[model samples]
Target: MNFKNFGSQKYLLSEKMSGFSSLAHCFTTREGGFSTGKIQGLNLGFRVGDTPEDVTKNYRQVCDDMGFSFDNMVLSRQEHTDNIRIVTEEDKGKGLTKESDIFETDGLITNLKNVPLGIFYADCVPVLLYDREKQVIGAIHSGWRGTVMGISAKAVEIFKEKFGSEVKDIVCAIGPCIGPCCFEVQEDVAQHFDSEYVLKKENGRFNIDLWKANVDILASAGVPRENIDIAEECTKCKNQIYYSYRAHGKEHTGRMCAFIELKD
Candidate 1:
């Protein structure tokens, strides 16, 4: 991932997807917007106790900074489920500008140009995908539940079955989340992940490496290891730069997103 600062909106771009001239993708930070309080500065989620007006302005700031039409970006209601939604031009402005009919879906895939598909996060893993050959884009919100459900692999499956995309042509971008350093969990949570992805601390707590787990999932699903890029930044460890649900809980932290659009 390459760090970039455009005015006040600082973000990271996926190196694997950077060479594609038809699209724009970003893993945004918590700086640069009108939001305030617990969900302060560049907050993108309206449901996270942030005012709708401020959230709308924050969205505008990013859309403007990234040269995206605010109405063409589709933001969905994520419930940490493995549900994947196929987005079309009709779904434009659904969650952000218009009233959202989409609910409980944690994944989004689209082929339309100028339509930015986005997934929000604040520690939970955000996996954005692009198939340069097929011009397909996807965004996934893979929290522990979605990770356990294998959402990333499921997305790759959908890319093949629905879009006829070759796995080798697909590039996966794993954004910043809660790294294993501070993703300590109890025995019940640790038991769900594989032994390899979980680390048993001397204190009896377990740390889960979500990045590796998701990368392995994409790899196993047929995407080449070279096509996957991971942002090693941990939202929990670097809460000052990004939002961290683990660092502040649902009631306290703001939200960031992995957003991508197929340009015309």
Candidate 2:
């Protein structure tokens, strides 16, 4: 992943996906926007107690910086489910200019040109997938629950079943989130994942490696290991740059946006 600053706005772009000229994608940071107070600066989530006007301005700022149309974006409701929404032209502007018709959807895939798929995240992992050959793109929000449910792998299946996308041809970029060093979980949460992905610390706490878990899940689902790029930056650790729900607490931290759109 590469950090880019456009004017005052900053975001992360996948180096793997950057080579594709027909696609535009970005993982937004908590920098550069019209928001203020606890949800200050680039808080893209409307439901996060940010002013609606400020949230809309944030979207516009990101769209202008990333060269994507805010009017052509489809935002995810993101209820931590493995549900994948196959986006089309009809879904454009939903959750932005209009009320979102999509619900309980944590993953979004689309082949439609110029229509951006947007997903919100703070500490939760943001997974971006693109099939260069099929001209299809997907953005997924995988919280621990969604990760255990294999939402990234489910996105691979949707690509194949819906767009005839081959796993080998798909490149995935796992964006910044809470890493193993900080994501200490309870026994109940740790039990859902395999032992290999969880580490028991000296303090009687278990740390879950969500990054490795999601990568393994995607690989097991048939995406080539070489084709995946993990950002490796821990959101909790780098709370100043990215939003970290764990570090800043739910009430204070703002939500970031992960976006992908196929070029027209």
Q: Which regions of candidate 1 fall more than 4 Å away from where they truly are?
A: none
Cα distance off (Å), candidate 1, residue 162: 0.9
Model 1 whole-model lDDT (C-alpha atoms): 0.90
Residues 1-264, model 1: lDDT tens digits:
888998887898988889778989899999888998877788888878889999889888899888776987888888889999999878998988788888999999998999898899999999999999999999999999999999999999999999999999999999999998989999999999999999999999999999899999899999999999999999989998999988878787888988999999
Q: Count the backbone clashes (under 3 Å) in each candidate.
A: 0, 0
Cα lDDT for residue 124, candidate 2 = 93
Quality of model 2 by C-alpha lDDT: 0.91
TM-score (C-alpha, index-matched) for candidate 2:
0.98
TM-scores for every predicted model: 0.98, 0.98
Clashing pairs in 1: none
* Per-model CA lDDT versus the true structure: 0.90, 0.91
Candidate 1 worst ten-residue window by lDDT: 64-73
Give the C-alpha miss distance for residue 74 in model 1, angstroms: 1.0
